[model samples]
Target chain A: MNLGGRHAVSTLNDIIEIPIDAEGDIVRARGTGRDICRTLGFAEINQVKVATAISELARNIHQYAGKGRITLKVLGAPRPGIEIVANDEGPGISDTKLVLSGTYRSRTGMGKGLLGARRLMDYFELVSAPGKGTHVTLRKFVR
Target chain B: MAAIANFEPAATRLARFAALRRALSQAESVDAIAEHTLAFVQTALGVRSAALYASTREDEDFALIASAGDADLPPSLDRTSPFIVELGASKGDLSKTRELGSMWGVDRAIPAWQGDNLVGVLFVTGELELEIVDELQFELERALTVSIVAMLREEELAVLAIQERELVGLLREVQERDALMRADLEKARDFQRQMLGAVPRVAGAEVAVTFEPLELVGGDLYAVAALDGLLRVFVADATGHGVRACLTTMFIKSEYEIVRSSAAAPSSLLAQLNDAIAKKYQSAEMLFSAVCADIDLATGATRLAFAGHPPACVVRAGAAAMIGGGGPLMGLRPRMRFELVELHLDTDDGLYLFTDGFVEARATSGEQFGDDRARDAIEAAHRAHADVGAALKSASEAFVGGAKASDDATVVSVRRVSPEEQAPPSLAPASAR
Candidate 1:
């Protein structure tokens, strides 16, 4: 559901809103995503992958942005997959190109979360610039 | 109905009062008192109804307790009313009351007292009268008053016993819950200790590490990588306490391993560690202070970096010099740059990579075992050529004077083993596990 003038993929009832502010909210965000994925007939392995991706994105927004939200939309008909979006007003990635090119892994110890999330899902789109904010949209088709 | 005249015979009046006492002697409750008093009033003075009013507690005013006969008597006695004020002023003398009982449709009321406090009152509707029997009337009131006080004392004791039982039950519940929680914590502490793995033996150096968590589980962690020719030491202190902080350490340990062997520089390893936490928990306010030092065995070159962590030291000839490479904390952001401290140590020198918990330990006099004292303790050990871990730990304990540790402390000593001091190749690194 579109809370504002943003893209409206599903109605209010079909969208699950998880606001990530504290540590516990990150778990809740992924748990909700996993449950929805399972109900949509996702395979057990896919369920785990989806859940891990949700955790990565939610944790990203929570730790770096300080505040953000994750919305999961259950796609229907032509495409049956869960569409997840993470939105935040924190310091956005200045080099979006480098982040996806696998070089942004000057990270904790290994793979950058964005790169990992990108590989897990079928469709991934990231939009951002310095000082503006980061918006990530991801979808993995059941087919 | 039987009536006693104003000038009834003294013997007759005395006999009636004695009989009333005998009737109420077996009464146990307020209801029994009402029943016996009403019967006595009906047979002796021919009253139509009688009701008993009593205060439910010591602080309460009189309220309806029991009633018998015609039952049209006053329901209760309000302590604040003028009628009660005058009745209280009359003390136990019913003769001094000027018909105040008429306010609530009662002909006469008898006050029951336990010392100065009014425990109960007996109101009669139709008391046709014995005018003044003096001592006999006073004797009748005292008989009822004694029974009322005894009933109240028994009720209070019953309530106290019930409350005590409930208190015991709640205490047991709390103790059981505490025991379960402690068991779970013990399991977590054991898992954390197991995950620490081994204190690796570097091909060119001697390594000794001592770790102590303040609680059953803590955030301090250390992992030694001596798999390849290069020896990398990673130590991290997550920014919290207990299980949550321990979980952070676990995450860091796993992520650090993923990139530890392949990292180009010690600074790059820390950067990758930062990216792992920053990208994963970027939305959370989670952070950790860490120090990573990688030493080249062939060249004796060391690259050490600190991220919101305390500085490490280089020991040369019984002296220590502090080296700081302060940088931003890990997590809560992405792509953070960490500064590096480059140093070199040969066969005669060593290095100490430790957490702030050691220096921040406090004594009974509120004195801190600060940087200066820490360096002094390390130098003292170096001069004597004693075991660094044992000497430093004992020095800290002595300075703390038995005070509890406020945080987790980890000290790792790395020194080159001279060609003469190197252990035999048959003495494997697996033994350190």
Candidate 2:
């Protein structure tokens, strides 16, 4: 079911929507991302990069948010690339800048989770508050 | 004139004998032959009562299959009984002991033999046994009695064959189901091994790990990370077993890696891990136990924390002592705080961390390998200058006495090497870059 608010976006033919609810769903969401990347003629290494990025995002929704939805789209106007959006209504991050800035308590953690996913995509956008939940949009172009 | 009278009776007897043979040869089942055979014996033999006994391969005795006219005979006769022996030893139809007839309450019992195997017996009371069968009108009836016994054996084999087929089908079905279950476990094991991280290499400290996974994939995991000047060892035991438990271990590994380098202390890292697991599967099945330790390689100063995990051993030269503060199980609630304790490890001193699987393992005699034994094993290993990891693993295995562990187990020990044992640094600054 579509939540259909500001988070909604028009997509082309290769749009696939999957709900991330459990731990197993993370693997499925990652697999679907890899398949679409391969179909679009992306290099093998870049395809792995995209799939690994999706794993971290899906893991957050499964671990922190408890439930969420992931939307995958093949972007045609964006130079034949892939666009993924992860939306969740669970407790959102209070501060997104510090995590992205990479000055986090980076000793024991893996670059604050979002910082790793952001590096894999050409375009990254994050919107959240303490209570408003989180929505992230990631895009990677063939070029 | 008397010879002509005898020829007339002999001709009549031959016609009667032919009729009896025709009737008995048509008996399809043993039950079908019972009434007809009894009627023939009672009337043609001039006997008051008659009974039939049949023996099958499964039976050790001839059982009274059918009886008519209430002949007083035993319900069954053992194969070795004197009554059956004497009857089997008879020439053809009647028991050899004609004078012993009243003892069996039967004048005669005609034995049916197929190649020396006693197949059946037909017993009759009244005047028939006392008369000589060759002189009597029913003399030719002996041949018909053998046909009834032959039919009984054939019917028994047919019943047994059908039962054997059904048993074979049931055995095959069970074997197929077992094969499927084994395949599932193997796949899960491969997945677990793939996601597991390697043990950490702490400088100046000798690190040894002991791990015991169950027959099926289990949730025990050891994740090590070398961060800055400390080696962070995260040992965890997730709840439950099987594929789901294996998946949870992977999830725990990923979460720990993400927060490990950023975490300020052992307690903070545990709190973050607890938050991640608790926030997910809110169900009780998601609970787990863990010990997080950050060892300072230079000073051998260790910061330790436990979340429902057993205490780690601080084994010095004299003896072993356990050190860890109280904490609740992870995944029960979010944002729960984990307490930490600080301990200093001198050179040659061993710091041992283990899951409950080590201390709670039971012997065949139902005795648990409690904390005291674990202390002794770790202490003895260090005092003997032995490999502490192998010592702990073998000690627990010997305690369980070759029984498969009921739960998964993991042990990690990092001891600061004494100055005499430490190797040279073996590295230069790469010609000053």
Candidate 3:
């Protein structure tokens, strides 16, 4: 998305893009997201939630897809907020519903991984197809 | 009128001057008072050299003490011509002008006195007119004594002050070192507390742990953690006491947290712990002795593993027996396998774990309290009280009574929950629990 312009720039809403790999490149992207939220005077509790959400999504990409990329940008003006987009071309989810279900579990038996990330953050969405891979996005606002 | 009857005023004055000069020459020793007298005579009479001599009466020798001369005699000038004649002269005797060059080199002699005895003499060996010498002798004697005494006192005080400063500096260094040691000890003590874990609250068990440190920092450690449907407990004693031992325990606890999530079996947990500890403490002389157990609240089944530790006692049905056969101590060897012993617990059965401080306590006669005595005390407490917490406390107190625990004393008690207590809705499913 073209979240660029003088008006967008003056609004103090910046865009940051990062490519992920096994070397943990997305950690830098997550840290940038937290810094952007903090600079916009977001609450510490909200900023931490956004940072953690970004980290979890980024880690999920590295773990499931082997490698991916993420984009974190501040959106809207006057009432500034954050948007995180993480996409990976890994083996597509065979059962998206089951993966998102609370009953589904990882080897650690921590079934609440995706559900927990959604609960802690303000906005969450997930889209995936069997052969096409997955796209996940999260949003948090300064207010 | 002068020719007929003349009284010479100049002659009378001259006589008095001669007598005073003679007295200076006969005076003995060159102490502060005598040194002052020589200085005064030199300044007032304008004599070039004035020296005071101290005499050895037994040897009839005189040694120079204070001198202002062309070449001062080395502090010992004895039985020479000038000194010998000067000593022979009695009080009030004076030597007339005599130039013996370097052999005697005396221009004049003045007697020095000590009470009525002729102690020594003062010699003036420079050109001075007789008139001025006669006039200045008395004033010189008075000033010399005062100056020498003051200079001597000043020298003594300077030496004393230097000594005092050195002592104060040494004391300050010791105090600074002591404060640093105390701060380090406090940090170690806080770390030890963190390693022991927060006091555990088991759903079906009453757990009471008391740690009595011999000092600010101690070597003993005990912890209880409820993780993954199992209650894990451990009590460890590191070799020696204080900072080094405390650090060993902390290292073990950190390693424990990492392994504890996956290892549900006691022997497996101990094996992992031993391998990690052996690698970390290979260079250290100290090692860890511990008993680790996993108790399932739902099944009342406990698996215990020991590594050269004092065995824990299980009190059930009015009888007590030690749990777990001992194994090699941790950190001693690599790849050492720990033996695991499993036991089924009846409701309300109690388990007691303690360090060697209890049984190893010595009496006045230097005999150990012994394991048998310790077992008897536990039995007595169990007979007196049904509650496991009370029994353990009473037993330890009675066993160590009046004798101080030479090492760190620690106690951990666990009691199995009855079926009724497990019936609560909050309890997890039997499989999960």
DockQ of predicted model 2: 0.01
Report the poorest 10 consecutive residues by lDDT, candidate 1 chain A.
Answer: A1-10
The DockQ-derived docking category for candidate 2 is incorrect
lDDT-best of 1 and 2 = 1
Taken in order, the candidates have interface RMSDs of: 36.2, 39.3, 44.4
Off by over 4 Å in 1: A1-143, B1-153, B383-385, B423-433
Q: Candidate 1 at B166: error in angstroms? A: 2.3
Docking class of 1: incorrect
Give a tens-digit lDDT track for model 1, residues B103-133: 6667766665656766566677773443532
Per-candidate TM-score, first chain only? 0.88, 0.86, 0.81
Q: What is the interface RMSD of candidate 1, in Å?
A: 36.2
Model 3 ranges with Cα > 4 A deviation: A1-143, B1-32, B35-50, B53-104, B107-121, B124-165, B279-281, B284-286, B382-405, B417-433
Candidate numbers sorted by lDDT from highest down: 1, 2, 3
Residues A26-129 of candidate 1: C-alpha lDDT, one tens digit per residue: 77887778878878889987887687778778878877899999999899989899999999999998877445544334545122567667666777778988
lDDT accuracy of residue A66 in candidate 2: 95
B201-279, model 3: which lDDT tens digit per residue? 6677656676766677777888788875578888888898777777677777778777777776878887888888788
**Stretches of candidate 2 exceeding 4 Å from the true structure:** A1-143, B1-163, B166-173, B400-404, B418-433
Q: How accurate is candidate 2 locally (lDDT)?
A: 0.71
User: Candidates' lDDT values, in order?
Assistant: 0.73, 0.71, 0.64
